[model samples]
Target: MQKTYKVQDDEPERSILARLITPDQNPGDDPLEELHGLATTAGTDVVDELVQRRSSADHSTYMGKGKVEELRLMVQKHDADLIVFDNDLTPAQIRNLEKATGAKVIDRTELILDIFAAGARTHESRLAVELAQLEYSLPRLKRMWTHLSRQAMGVGMRGPGEKQLEVDRRLAQKRISDLKAELKQVEERRERQVSARKEAPTVSLVGYTNAGKSTLMNALTDANVLAQDKLFATLDTRTRRWNLPGWGTVLLSDTVGFIRDLPHSLVASFKSTLEETRQADLLLHVADASSPTVFDQIAAVYAVLKELGIEEKDTLLVLNKIDAIHNPAILNRVLDRYPNAIPVSARSNKGLGCLIEAVGEALGREFLDIAVEVAPSDGKLLGYLSSKGEVLSREFGDESTIVHVRMPAGAMGPVHKSALSIKPSTLMDEAKAAEEASANSSEVA
Candidate 1:
């Protein structure tokens, strides 16, 4: 088996000069480290890092006057190919930074977007990246693509090359619009597929990037999705049928992992792709239990889910990578903090039973306990109930058969209403009388 690195090797890596600048009173979480991670994820080799403390961000340049000069010198010293900022920069700031550093300057958002562009495999994901890239580049168009006009050999007559970049810009704008329309169609198709799944229960795996979501999906559904110890391994959503003991089968999907400061353009572009998760009946919120910032990661996932308007949906917090946690106290602390969380090891398959049980319990809470009775003549009706719901018991009672089943709450009303219409004439009369008697007793009481 081959191992994958968070950062790539070979292919002649580009030298990157990075900086982390934050305002005073900022609760900075070492954005330079994150920038380096992003650069590495994008296959760039970081050669130097610079940090500056400012009261507030510079409007035209992200760094302070003195810090900008320092960064310029550092870029020259390292002979860097590019300069990456630890935060998102305005178009003006990006232009100023690029001019000052004499290197292509990008912010954290662009770096992440580039990584997404590089990692995207599926058609929808690629389209999404193209849309996001265009959106990000739209505002930075002027300063970034200003080299549209060049000179050719001139005699007495005027001489100039074609303005290819202007054409490129226009083409990009058109492509963005085209992609939006394409994505809308894709979204509608996805909506229809999701609506079809409404008849069946759905479970979605969501968590921080590289939190073993794909591995868990493989473990649960025997899916062969690519699961690696790197960021954003699974970009597009993949769904498969998972067979359970009592429930028979349900739909389980693996979706793109969430990260801190996920680009807004990405959120906007991939909204359709993520609808799989937003529309799920249940969410398996996988967390890297061994990570130091597991709590923060959980918060990030919750924040994204809330933004998508799915925070109120049923969720099962799955603490993955339990096998990597050697400190019992730390594990105990996590358990204390998240009482409902189930710890599991995706690699070792440790404590998977607990996760499955937790999922079953979550389903139980949202399902209905239905008592269905069908006459012997309606054996087909009994089969339909047994196939669709969890049949707890069936007993023959002379004229009629009694069935107790558990089904999704939303399905109960239709199933019960259908049962009433299908009930034998004698049984229907008895049922109506029993219902009337119960109503009369309640009214009298």
Candidate 2:
């Protein structure tokens, strides 16, 4: 990867950022912060930024004629080589804008694809990004070859340019089909891998890009999964074992981050990459507490989850990067809004214990606390208790031994099969009923 904010000569791809805003929408302070970040991440030197107030995009150029002239002047002033828009544009609009501004123009979707292309490290991620890029370019191929001809073709085209266009279209479509089939196989394999781990408690980290999820993963499990401060720094999924203090071992997974207005093709292509998030028992929604647009980023993440049909999954809101927020009021405001959200700084290790305990409580909601009395010679049951549950304490008597343990609800069947008599303090009615009955038990203790 290129050094961030490197000297100009290395990559002189100077760009001017542009966006169209509308009334009844909150632009907030610095409406272009996200676009600026994206452009910088794609290794473009942002020369200047321009905004226009419009009810809707102009049909021909997306930007109006007057604004186009102004943009052309601005580009000339900055000697910009590119113009990046925050809105998705039709192919014709992109062509018109490029012609009007005398600079190469790319819309938000294309910019995001470029970033994904740069950050793709793994083979799976590279394939997914390539698929998305191909999908985005399939429709724009005509404009790319525009210099050849502009005449409309009718009743069996005859020109060499049109013939090449047809050839390119066929080639792109074939490649797109091939990519889809390959990704489908990847998705199937990922499903099997995730399903094999169904017996373990699985938790996945999900959030907006650059939200400190990788940092948290490293802090929790020493995953060493490439934690960085840039957006979309890591584009692959990584799973590791996290020991939940008293709750045995659990599997924790990290996935590609979400973004606002994420390209639909990219999301569909990355279905295999998102398999872990879909199959997870619980999701940790990490967010940056210090960002002004934190709520917007949070909403964007949910939108992506909804697209994946997992919006209803059990999720814990984790407000990360708490150490970066110096103002108590900002965090207090967030807490006021989301009272149940856990705040923790993955960098400073502040509040991590609380986060872990909260996770324990969430995963152990169906657990049962019981005291089982058994013969002193029953080492088999004792070993099971030690392995499957957390043994709180023990009592020794001349005739019997009583062991206090907290275990999953599923473990009750085996313990009952062992013909053990017990005192039960489980919260649910089912456990209570189970404790009250035992054919082999003389009485409930």
Best by lDDT: 2
Output the lDDT of residue 23, model 1.
46
Q: Tell me the deviation in Å of residue 213 in model 1.
A: 0.5
Weakest 10 consecutive residues of candidate 2 by summed lDDT? 425-434
- Return the lDDT, model 2, position 359: 91
Question: Please, what are the lDDT tens digits per residue for candidate 2 over residues 1-445?
Answer: 8778756566659999999987866767999999999999999999999999999889999878899999999899999999999989999999989888899999999999999999898888988999999999998898967778645668665566788888999999999999889999999999877765544678899999999999999999998888988889878999999988989899999999999999999999999999989877678999998999998988999999999998977789999999999889999999998999999999999999999999988887746788887788888898777656678888788988778887655556668877358777443336646666663375533
Task: List ranges where model 2 is wrong by over 4 Å.
Answer: 1-9, 150-152, 366-445
Q: Model 1's lDDT to the true fold?
A: 0.79
Deviation from native of the Cα of residue 117 in model 2, angstroms: 1.1
User: Can you write out model 1's per-residue Cα lDDT over 273-358, one digit (the tens) per residue?
Assistant: 99888767789999999877777788999998888877888898999998999998878888999998899998889998888877
lDDT to native, each model: 0.79, 0.88
Worst 10 residues of 1 by lDDT: 153-162
CA lDDT, candidate 1, residue 199:
49
lDDT score for candidate 2 against the true structure = 0.88
